[model samples]
Target chain A: MAVSRGFVGRRPTDSARVPPGQYVTRDFPVLSAGPTPYTPLDTWDFTVRGLVNRPVSWSWQAFRALPHENITVDIHCVTKWTKLDTTWSGVSLDTLLDAAPTQASHALAFCDGGYTTNVPLADLRGGKAWVVDEYDGQPLDPEHGGPARLLVPHLYFWKSAKWIRGLELRQADQPGFWEMFGYHNYGDPWKEQRYQGD
Target chain B: MVSKTVETPRVTTIAVAIQDWPGHRAGQHVDVRLTAPDGYQTERSYSIGSAPEDAYVSLTVERLDDGEVSPYLVDELRPGDEIELRGPVGGYFAWDNELGGPLFLVAGGSGLVPFRSMLRHHRASGSRVPVRLLCSARSLELLIYREELIKLAADDLVDVSVTLTREAPDDWRGYRGRIDPALLAGCRHGCFGA
Candidate 1:
């Protein structure tokens, strides 16, 4: 590693809290691969399918009627920004998976804008992930993934697919959109897995 | 490092020569990693501003006031300074002449970096693709690649429109205010589906 001649970083106080090669950012930067998609609430729905005992889906009204939890978690983007204690309200993936009854060990989250991210089913179970709609007690904005988005805080933010439409459980692992391009199939920010072969 | 040019007060373009660099497509980015004297390292991704046809890879960076990396990249780096970076990363957002289109490119602030690469590629490859670039900047003075973009707009197949969101010269004519649905709808005619 070539040391930059006169470079000095912020030297974040809680170094232990941050993953390797990451810095804390109070401002949530908006990064996208395409134009922001606005899905009308009247037609919005979430589904769980593929290799499940039976497919299950919830309309916007039915989804809101289900139990909700207010969670505060630290989110780390693969781009190297970490936001701490971001509060969100949503239904847990466990809640959804419980209904679907899947024996699959992998999942592919598909979104409205054709964005997809794969995660192991093991990482998403036992109250580990959610389908969040409210951020900081306010309706999530379109630019920040409104309507509903997958909230898998443990993995890189990209794995938390925005404008999330459904989770398709798979019998075997498969690469998602970014994974197929260059990103790591299982992006673990703590491992500094930003690209393929991190 | 090859050369540096001041694009705007807050933006600077750095050109670097990479060894055995596989040529990159337009709209690709590179991950720049900087290590301090103490081994405290940070990395950031920057969109390539130079076309694959260009002799050197170029990255135009905008200095964010509170940004840790941008300030160093824009203000401190110099020619001959060794910097560590990787790739030609990203494929989803890349554009090439083969992807023929009446392309509609929209950008605000430094977001125009990748489109610069695309535009340059279009010119270098002699692509006849109809291109429309809608760019927004706080002011004319703050627009990156101001002169180059104007010269590129001279092409019959390319149309460039600028919207000054903050300030404009008294006699300036182009566009003013933010890019909203109305402005997009006006630009979308005959270009999107046709």
Candidate 2:
């Protein structure tokens, strides 16, 4: 299938949209997030392709059927909030790739809404990442990447692709959303990997 | 910067209706957190886009394609929902009058959010520190803080220079490109707040 347009380099523009001090929430969400998701499982479709000798596509059911496992861990974002004691369930990318047999050295992930992040297959294997399908025993909610999402616990939260579509196995790696916009491509919370220059 | 973690709100953005907002300096940000359905929680640090005088915090977020926690904060979030956040994170990035100089703010996309507070502080206290901003976006329509930025420019409170990457056929007459030094140099220094 045709891929959506990737983040293209564009000249920058500026706006003083809202007045300063006006948005100061007496209280703020503990997280930096996009609009809450409205993902519906019936509406979800996950695909994995690229550089692999054979690309694989899995429907939600087909995806869940592949394998199921649960793990509890802490995740940190470069933005600096660390959430601990989180339980997530899903199929491991390594386990899945074990069957698919990826010949590609590099990997780029794409999501349902067409966002992409470049990563290394080595990072995936080394990080003990997975394509998580469930959270806290119940099937994951759509807003939380219901059907499935990529969970890279070691890297910053941005590495966790929401509404994940598939993996594009490439010979080389590429940066994802925040990376293209100047966030550090390899986000390590321990090192405070927030900005590109950082 | 002092911070205390709170609970995630039902909505993403809110009026920050809590009484007695903790005092914070301009150009500071509060760290926010939220709990996912499965008890998995996520956190992100955002610039306190509002000035200390303002009643609430406002964050302008562009949905990241795979932002595990961000999408909920940006898209599904609304005002009046409960959420968790810690006050006024980051010290150096925060604006301090003591730093003492005309301020030139350059922001890329949502990066401009924190600078908003700086402008407001300057405006309220009459800092007169010569503030200028170079905001870069793909198009004029996509410009955030469009109305406010223009008003500030018009009022001579701040010197605003804008560059558009993708111009509409009808809107290509002015500043048709990236922010070059020329744009920065041309901006008349406007300063009311330090």
Candidate 3:
């Protein structure tokens, strides 16, 4: 390893909480591949389709009527910023997936801006993920995927597709926007898997 | 590192020579990793500043008051120091001359870094894409590539408009305040066919 001269990292007191090559950040950094889409709540809806016994869809009003949970979780961005204890409220993927039974093992999360990210159905089940519309007691801003966004806290934040629309269950796994590029298919920060070959 | 240039008060551009670097496209980024003497390592992604035609990879870093890596990159590391970096990664945002245009690019602060690569690629490739750029910075003094942007604007095919959000010089003659829909509409009108 090439040691940088006179460079000492933040050296977080709780080092174990931070993944390797990552640092803690209090401020939320907004990163987007394109302009933020402003989808009116009335037209916004969430769906679960493809490889399911029966497709399911929920309009904004109906989705909000579903049981919601307040969650505080650590979000790790592949950019190396880890914001811990971020609070959010949303309907769990299990609640939505339970409504539509599927034996498929993977899903391609499609968003409003033509952006997509793939996640294992297993990761989306068991309350591991949610389609969040609220962050920190306020309606999520359009820039932060207001209306709704998929929240998969375990993987890199990019996998948490903003402006999330629906999940298309797939029999085989495939690459999404960043994954088609150089980013790793499964971005696990703990393993330092950032690039395709990493 | 081959050379370093101070772009602004808080920004510095560092060019490094890479061995067998597989040249990158415009708007690509690289992951820069730095290790401490105690074996502690940290990494951050930075947009590539140099055009693909350039001989070396250049990265423009903006110093953040509390940033773990930016401060060290902007203020400390010197030429000839070895730093580990990966890629020219992220193709989702990359641009190439083949894409063709009426291209419209908008950037604020350090966000202009990648567009600089695109604009350079635009010029170097001799692409006659009618390009319009609307850049925003806190002030003229804080603007990166101020001189180069002026030179690029001289091209009949390229139009560069800057907006100073916070402060502007007494003689400044450009847009002011944050980018609003009206400004965007005007910019869009200039590039895209009405």
Candidate 3 Cα misplacement greater than 4 A, ranges: B188-194
Task: Report how far off residue B166 is in candidate 2 (Å).
Answer: 42
Q: What is the lDDT of residue B178 in candidate 2?
A: 73
lDDT of 1 by residue, A147-193 (tens): 88899998999999999999999999999989999999988888899
lDDT of 1 by residue, B46-127 (tens): 9999999999999999998988889999888989998998898999898999999978999999999999999999999999
Query: Highest lDDT among the candidates is held by which one?
Result: 1
Per-prediction DockQ comes to 0.79, 0.05, 0.79
Of the true interface contacts, what fraction does each candidate have?
A: 0.90, 0.08, 0.92
Ranking by TM-score: 1, 3, 2
TM-score for candidate 2 (chain B): 0.80
lDDT of each model, Cα atoms only?
A: 0.90, 0.63, 0.90
Query: Rank order by lDDT, top first?
Result: 1, 3, 2
Binned by DockQ into CAPRI classes (incorrect, acceptable, medium, high), candidate 3 is medium
Per-residue lDDT, model 3, residue B46, is: 96
lDDT of 2 by residue, A106-183 (tens): 778887666677767887884389989777788777677656778988777778887778888877677776577656
Worst-scoring 10-residue span by lDDT in model 2 chain B: B1-10
